[model samples]
Target: MKNNTPSTAHLKGTRTETAHDGNAKVWLNGKQLNLQASLKYCSKSPTGFNWGYGGSGPAQLAHEVCRQLYGLETANLVFQDFKWRFLVTIEGDTFDLTLELEEFNVGHVMPLIETAEDTDLCETQNGPTGHGETCYFDADQGL
Candidate 1:
């Protein structure tokens, strides 16, 4: 049998690199985000990978992206099939969520994120989500 799926880079570099200056340029909702201003720490477990953030800006972007993609009314993080999924609710009483996975290509593992929008809650405003939280997981953690 021959493989025909497109190559994807997810969680590239050694585990140490994840702890290094890991940055990402995430594109969502028609905008490009440059995150990792305060590169905290990234850990990989059986479930998937989790990264911590510093500055408020990075936190906000991650929060919105996660909520919009996960259809979460509050804030939550889940994992499935070696992929990390974030859930959050937007300001307009709408739900959203984000899913992230590592794409491997030879010697590269890059992250690929996808978002899902349920409804247009553009006018909803109740403040940001997922902040001031430190997450820890096991290296062999699986979902």
Candidate 2:
């Protein structure tokens, strides 16, 4: 069986685990989740990843986590909130955030995804936004 969970539509049992040693590390299922994909869209932290704060590194992590479980589109939709909600709360160096995607009610963001299907969720002029940046998705108003 594969340890890492790749991005897909069926992400019911997927899990995202983040650990902080000297730096941040993200794991999907039992394997490490890569950050290159997320960075391709928007490079945040080229050195490494971090959490417990609303910053570039955390934003990169948020995007990667969602991207790993879902896909690029969905990751763009929810990564901002992901950084604010879960990542920022991770305090201390020895933290483990095992997010069971399904149990975490990731489906709640589906409405936003549906809206995304009709309208482009990433409506930023500069591209995907980082933490504390304007993560708005709309023609007029935004999220």
Candidate 3:
């Protein structure tokens, strides 16, 4: 029996920013995001944001912003499960920051396959045996 299963795959992409007037701006999927402005917004929120003293803070903020902007569950899962490296610049100062996801398990579920087809539906008479019948196969039995 041949197994056809989808495995967890890495969804990776890059976000690059150019420094201008002490701020860095990046265009992601045609949407422009300002690094400094996002950080400021997060910081000013009532909950408050800390880019941690250890320097992992900015990267976390960036990931969260990306997740919010691009609402894809799979991409968000990858972001939360993988370490991401970001290149940020501030007033000519460049920082290479690494962000790691908290340990967690992603449940795997077998996908349902639809093998039964309506063989009664045929387009042309040039089918098997010139009978205009569609053929369906049972791969497991090699029929």
Highest lDDT scorer: 2
Q: Give the clashing residue pairs of candidate 2, or none.
A: none
- Note each model's CA RMSD in angstroms: 16.1, 7.4, 18.6
Candidate 2 residue runs with Cα over 4 Å from true position: 1-23, 100-108, 121-143
What are the lDDT figures for the candidates, one per model? 0.29, 0.57, 0.31
Sorting all predicted structures by lDDT, with the top scorer first, yields 2, 3, 1
Q: Give per-residue CA lDDT, model 3, range 1-143, as digits (tens).
A: 11232232222223224222223333433455444454332222222222222234344344444344323222222322222332233222333333222122222111111212311211222345653222334455443
Model 1 misplaced regions, further than 4 Å: 1-53, 74-143
Put down candidate 2 lDDT per residue, 24-135, tens digits, no spaces. 5566555675666556765666655677789777877777777666566666667777778677877665454456444333444656554654564543424444422325
- Of models 2 and 3, which has the larger lDDT? 2
TM-score of each: 0.23, 0.62, 0.26
How many pairs in model 1 have backbone atoms within 3 A of each other, for residues 3 or more apart or on separate chains, i.e. clashes? 29
Best-first order by TM-score: 2, 3, 1
Leading candidate by TM-score: 2
